[model samples]
Target: MRREITGFSNPTVKLLKSLRDKKHRKREGLFLAEGLRLLTDARACGRLPQMLVMATARDPHPLLDALEADVLASGGEVIVTSADILSKITGKDNPQGVAGVFAEFDTSLDRLDRSSAKIWLVAQALRDPGNLGTMLRTGDAVGAGGLILIDDCADPFSVEAVRASMGAVFTQGLAQAGWDDFLTWLRAGEGQLVAASLREAVPYRGAPYAAPCFVMVGNESRGLPEDYELACDLRVTMPMKGRADSLNAAVAAAVLAYEVLASLEG
Candidate 1:
């Protein structure tokens, strides 16, 4: 069944808009993702949003039609509202015509199947939603099975990160865990923990990267702690010849991911 939400004062509107904040999302156990492409990607990934919000004048499309149909067929609800309301919900001046509310996934370390792919991306204290999303995008690009966030990372389901991921959030498996828990989990499996480092590290290129190699990056500002680096099976460094001393956390992951990809694929 479908519904229409026309008033800004509507409690549904308020709840939908509240999803823009982490607290509301945590309370509701739902996160919002805007844009038709992201919704379509979610659908393709065998996920259907529990609630779909669409603008009243949205242009017709087969994909959107398919999405709406699937949502209804699966006993989900659709709300048709004005573009301005969509803007309010998304906190965007020019909101995408559609948004979806999906339940957060199981993000425990045990839910991750490490042996499924050759490379995995891990971030420690990554604070930026955009960077987190970019890491997910990089994971998708490198054909990694998933992204494992270790300690105090950005919320993977935040709208900004979801938007930045460009649908990689839906495609990539995501797990969040404390550093010690993650290390314990990794040790229990046949996985290699690798990170970018400067303390007696090898060049990132052509390293002895193996299947299930975890390419780890540290906090955007603080870098990795000494103990964290020491725990890694390998520590490789990227060259910084120019004035820039280091790469962005997400960029570093992408570069290291690609190198690891080449090494394992070769």
Candidate 2:
């Protein structure tokens, strides 16, 4: 059934407002997706939000029609509200015309397909949401099996991260582990551990990225811990002729990931 929410006190509106916070989102086991493109991408990835909220005065009406149809067909509720309500939900004065509340996908480590996982990414203590989001997109582009977040990393489901991913969040499998637990898993896994480092590392092109490789990257400010770097089977570095000490973490990961993929194709 289509419902029209006219007041802020409505239960659904309150719930949507609470979801803007990370703690509330975690407690509810749901995340909010905003914008038409993101919702379309969510549907493409086989996710139907439990509830969809739309601003009543969207200029391009056909997109809203399609979105409403898809949501209703999947047994989801569609709520139409004023522009003010949409702005309140998304914290933007000029908000997108649509938003959705989706249950979090299972990103547990054990859920990954070990056999077919040609390359896996491990991001350690990633603090930046935008970087992590781009990494998710890059990982998907390079056909990585999944991404594992070790230690204190940004929430992939956060609004900033999700927006930065450009919908890649729905397509990429994700996992979380601590440094020690990740080390244990890495030791038991059957792939070459390739890490990026400046000290005692070979050129990126020279490193052998064996099949079922696991690429490890460190935090934005701090590179991998020496012990972690030592654990890797190989370490590689990108060429830096400019004055910059290091490249953006996402760019560096993409370059290495594509290189690894290209090697396999060759």
Candidate 3:
């Protein structure tokens, strides 16, 4: 169905805006993504948002038109409102002119197939949404099957993270689990859990990197907890030449991911 919403007080507006809050998103089992590019990337990845919303003043684009048609053909709703109202819903002064409501798909760790890819990225207690999104992108770039988010990481479905992912969210598989649960699942199958740590560690390059190697990173501020680092089958450390003690959590994951990819492919 195609609907035009002009009033900010509309109930649908309220519902879409509420998705910005984690509690509301969880309760509704839905999350929001904005921007024509992100939504278009999602469409290309076989993920059509349940609801596609756009501003009446949005500039015309072939991609946007194609997206709208695809959404409607797939039984999705299309909403058009003023850019002002779009900004209000997105909590951004400059809205992307388009936003979407997507049903949160399955993210259970059990659904992950370990042998599907040579490398996987894991994050523990990641607090920053941008970092989480960047890791997802890194996983996509490295040809990792997906990203397994461990413990209390930021909501990957959040707007900031989703935006930062630049559409990797739709392209890459995502899973969430606690450390114990993740460990059990990883140990059940043929996989190597490698952590970036100094304890009993070898240099990251030319490390005994193996197929389905799970390159795990830790909390941004604290890094990996000692026991968690120790639990890994392999510990690899990167050199820090500058005054900075370590790379950002996401950067570390990307750096380590590329190294693992090169080692496995070469």
Candidate 4:
């Protein structure tokens, strides 16, 4: 039988809303996914959702119907609720009428072995969830080995980040480490640490795109950290011909990741 939750005050609705916090997600070992695309991707990846919530409306979205069937077939619970309830749960002015709670996938950096790894993207203090999500999607596209977020970075599992990633978050290997831990890993791997810097003499295209390398991109407003620069084997810059002195953090990461891929392909 399908469960119908009518109000924002519903117990299920409150639980979904609590997933917005990292602590709750950590304690429960679950995260919320919003929108059809993200939920679809999660299903496609075999990360079946624990619960599916849909807005109670006539002529519901076709995709939602498909998702409901899929979730039910997979032995998951489904709930129908009001649009107001969904908005309050997601804290979004415009709710997509569908959301899901899924088990958080493993994201351990220790599982990555430097011997077989090719390219890795390290984000230091990337505070924008959207940018982090885009980076993760692009990283998946470029077949990056994994992503490492240094201290004080945005939570990649956040709803906004997961939405922006379009479900890439579920597929990618992500790990959070402190600055010292990151440095230790980079040193142990002995991989090229290519820092993206505006003042660098070497252009991004000129940097060696050899296997088993790591590229570090810094925060949105601030560039690379001063101490981190000393750890970089090479500092590479993206050529800027336009009026803008720099590109967005996600755009910069994609440009560099693809370049590395192209170089490896050659």
lDDT of model 3 at position 44: 86
lDDT (Cα, 0-100) at 61 in candidate 3: 96
Q: Which regions in candidate 2 have their CA more than 4 angstroms from the true location?
A: 60-66
What local lDDT does model 4 show for residue 147? 82
lDDT of each: 0.93, 0.85, 0.92, 0.82
User: After best superposition, candidate 4 residue 115: deviation in angstroms?
Assistant: 6.0
lDDT of 2: 0.85
lDDT of 3 by residue, 1-266 (tens): 89999898999999999999999999999999999888988988899999999999889999999999999999999999999999988889999899999999799998888888999999999999999999988888899999899999999999888988988999888999999999989888899999889798999989999988999999989999999998999999999999987899999999999999999999
Worst 10 residues of 4 by lDDT: 192-201
lDDT of 2 by residue, 87-143 (tens): 898887778889998998786666777567688788989899899989888888898
| Model with the higher TM-score, candidate 2 or 3 | 3
Ranking by lDDT: 1, 3, 2, 4
lDDT, candidate 3, at 221: 93
Clashes of 3: 0
lDDT of 4 by residue, 110-134 (tens): 8766665577888999999999998
Best by TM-score: 1
lDDT of 1 by residue, 1-266 (tens): 89998999999999998998999999999999999999999999999999999999999999999999999999999999999999999999998899999998989889888878999999999999999999999899999999999999999989989989999999999999999999999999899999999988999987888888999999999999999999999999999999977899999999999999999988
